[model samples]
Target: MTAFLSRNLAARASMLASLIFLTACAALPRSGPNKPEIYDGAVERGGDAQVIFVNDHVTRASNFTPAYGFSNSFRNASAVGADEIRAGDVLGLSIWENVDDGLLTSLGASSSQLQQIQVDSGGYIFVPYAGRVRAAGSTPDQLRQVITTRLSEQTPDPQVTVTRVAGDGATVSVLGKVVGQGVYPIERPTRSLSAMLAKAGGVAIEPEIAVVTVKRGNSTGKVWLTDLYAGASNDIALRPGDIILVEEDQRSFTALGALGGQTRVPLGNEMISAIEAIAMVGGLNSNLADPTGVFVLRDEPEAVASKVLGKPVYGSQRMAYVLDLTRPNGLFLARDFYIRDGDTVYVTEAPMAQWRKRIGAVVGTIGSVNSVQNLAN
Candidate 1:
């Protein structure tokens, strides 16, 4: 190579290197970045739970049931009652020989609505006579012992009778966020949570989504609906008056951007890209859209922290992941950006666009007031 040609090529290369370095410096940014933070929550709690106000109007406790992704760890939340009584629930009521013969005959004659029987609003049947209540909350054997003790108190030698005239009144209600939400009566008493869910319509027919939650009344935890239904009796044996709810998966989003119209976007996974999400929202109005300050605001900002450490934690450090969409390859980084529920994909109007909107608003106000005065005159 000749010396002059080599010198010229070197100069061009030097200029290119300087330009590249300056660009890198511009990207480097002089300001310090925010800290990386984590959360201690699961995605299911509103995609990770930090409950603010229970929506008495929009949602009730039942809405949080398996019917609504709210699981009923009821067994874990509270104890399960015994499960061995049927339609023929019997009660033996008798007193000691102090009991008049006429009284004994009258008992046999009337067969009253149950001797000193009290039915709790929960449907538990309690009898106070032989003190042996079979259907209220006792198994056959438990009632026998109670009757024996009552006889012992009344007569040194006592005879007790047992018979079930009424059926069980335990019902597991399925409600909210489900295709079929109503009260389901359980007769067998040996049915499981799965059986109850099946009776409650399983899950609704929705595409690209499948998940069921069972929430107990005591706590805001959940059990998988399918796991309960893997088989008729895989787990979760139920009782009378238990509550089971089935809920649809609420994992979706909407992408609103600069376009002819807004779009409601459905997301299948946890992650979405700015470029792709924009496309899903019908792309931008290239003629007027400003891609510089494309800001994505996620829902439940408080939930981001606990999601990192695996629980609801403070999010003071992790404000949010901000991205610049103007660069050519910044689209790649958008893929890693996870869009959560209730997230807002806001595209700021360019300066010209904002000015146009303000002008239109002012003109509309003037036109309205002028029309009002003209009508009055």
Candidate 2:
């Protein structure tokens, strides 16, 4: 009877050990080391974790500014004064003598002479009788008056007309992943970057991932194409020699942990809220996700961290933002919160769900053992 009791005790101990092991396994996060801890109503900073609560105040964070190309007044000035001539421009010059001709009549060449001349390196064009005439920095009408005044000495009345033949000097280059890659000339009516892009056959890449870079003179700036079209303010006017490039959009984020699917989501031309991003990845796994531990991992700028927390944080290269979806207003805050590029949205497994799964597993193990014992009997 003592041996029988001893064997029964050993069996109970073994069952307890097996249950403990299963419980431990189920309690652990499925996302491995990347899972976020449950968030309470407090801010915690440790190691690489800089945790912040999602609230209305977070909307004021400076880093929330959308990235897109914008032009200052100085850059927009290029759109103005389109009629001004520049060096390297080709001009069509015509001169007519009022009196059927003195010099031109002798040559038997009609009363007028038309010549296509290219502006010289010195910004001047050589006229037949007018000698070196300054054409650069002057409109066609201005150059015509200057030529007529200069030729007054050679002929009693010289009529001069100047027309721009080609604007090789004032043109902007549209290249890089555009449907039509070429140099587009700038005319009197200045064109905006959007107009130039439309003329160039639109962008070849998807707008969300594509960045529009504008190189003007020695300065270079880039902006998301979506931002440019979302607002009129971002579509800066194109300047001469400005290079516009539309390259592949490479911004994306990874959704892991208790999400419905672990995948990389590209940040397209539109602003994506936290809720939108969660929905895009098929939301959280109902059986395993912790409602209070919805975390957005981001490599936040130090300054942004300082502003959001209202104090300086130390030793964090990235931030771990937690949202408690169990609260009445938690869903509202999630909808308002925006996700940045390279952010990781992680939903930790609920503790109770882990317990339930472990119980089921342990029960199944016991049933399997009982079935084997029955067969042995």
lDDT of 1 by residue, 1-377 (tens): 56676566656655654565455444432112111111123233333433221122212211121122323444433324444444334344543333434223354442223353434444345544444233455655665466667556544554454443334355566765566788665545435666566666666654234444444344443444554445433355555555655455565565544553465665643245556667776777765566654555443333434443345556432232345566664565554455655565656456566456555555554565455444433
lDDT tens digits, residue span 248-281, model 2: 7777878987888999998776678888999999
Q: What ranges in model 1 sit over 4 Å off?
A: 1-137, 145-169, 177-180, 185-191, 205-218, 222-254, 259-261, 264-276, 284-293, 299-321, 325-329, 348-377
Q: Once superposed on the true structure, which residue ranges of model 2 sit more than 4 Å away at CA? A: 1-29, 34-46, 55-63, 67-71, 74-78, 98-106, 112-114, 203-211, 221-235, 247-249, 313-317, 352-377
Best by TM-score: 2
Best by lDDT: 2
* Cα RMSD for predicted model 2: 5.5
lDDT of 1: 0.48
Task: Give the Å error, residue 324, model 2.
Answer: 1.8
Q: What local lDDT does model 1 show for residue 293?
A: 46
lDDT of 1 at 237: 56
